[model samples]
Target: MDRRKSLKIIGGSAIGIAGLVLADWKWQLADQLTHKGFFTFNEENLISSIVDTFIPEGLPPKVPSPDAKPLGGLSTGTDKFLYRLFEHCYEKETQDIVKTQLVNLDERSKSEFGKPFYRLPQGDREKLLISFENSEIEDEVNFFKLMKSQTIMGFTTVKEVMENYRGYKVAPGYFKGCVDMPSQA
Candidate 1:
């Protein structure tokens, strides 16, 4: 074979290898973005929908608002929180327990309350959510708690919550702690 032809083949091989590597890296990144922990895209969407509904827009200026960014949304804090949830909670069997409890809750709600979680009215949803919050289900080890924690953390950490809802001052340390009041007449 000619030396030029040999060089051409080597160059083509290197380019092909580089392309494959790049493609693989892109695929992995996209996969990680879509699937974090026990939440697939569909499950993530469902959870996001519920979260958005639970903590919808229009908060009074003073209370921290809920996190509205979906799993795929941009937020390093959220991404890290989610990855940890899956690693610490889901891999540790918390996710399985949560899934079972959710399924049981679905059956009970349909039989006793006549509505699926996603189908319930706003008030009913709130009621069920409160009940769920107070129940033994909270004791279970699963991805659910981790997922909830991440959501809450994200919501509270968001800029909107900090500035608009939580009433963050631009500079709060100017005031000294335990100021003495002047004598009043």
Candidate 2:
């Protein structure tokens, strides 16, 4: 080929490659933005529903303290906490299993109850979760167990629960080693 023809071909190939790379980069950025955390919006909503079912709203205080608020998973942001935990701490395989199981749970609810898991009544939701507890499928059983434990962990670790329910003290006063003991009457 002539020098000018060879140059034209080389320039065209480089431009095409650059364009492809730019397109791929833009696609990756959009994907990352849409999936900000480990879960998508719908998956996060499913998690919120599942956690709420595990720890429903308006639970009366265990000790009836005046400052105790009605405890619930959603109110404590347990779903978000779980999301961060899975995103940062869990293995990729575990995260994929949990995500798949969440979708499966919704599909199961629709198959059996004619509605999505999140839309089911509170009692129905409980019954469905209990069914998972009794499920013979290993994935179903594992998913249920993981979700239950994580929900409890997330709920108990929240600031509200730590302060109001558990009476967690940040600093328990100064120590004094030379105090005189009072005599018992």
lDDT (CA) per prediction: 0.58, 0.88
lDDT digits (tens) for residues 1-185 of candidate 2: 49999999999999999999999999977876776655886688788899989999885537447665677999888988988988899999899999999998899899999998889999999998899899999988999999999999999999888887788888879799999999999
TM values, all candidates:
0.45, 0.72
Ten contiguous residues minimizing lDDT sum, candidate 1: 68-77
Q: List, residue by residue over 28-90, the lDDT tens digit for candidate 1.
A: 889867775555553443454445444554434434437543322233244444444554655
Q: What are the RMSDs of all candidates, in order? A: 11.5, 13.3
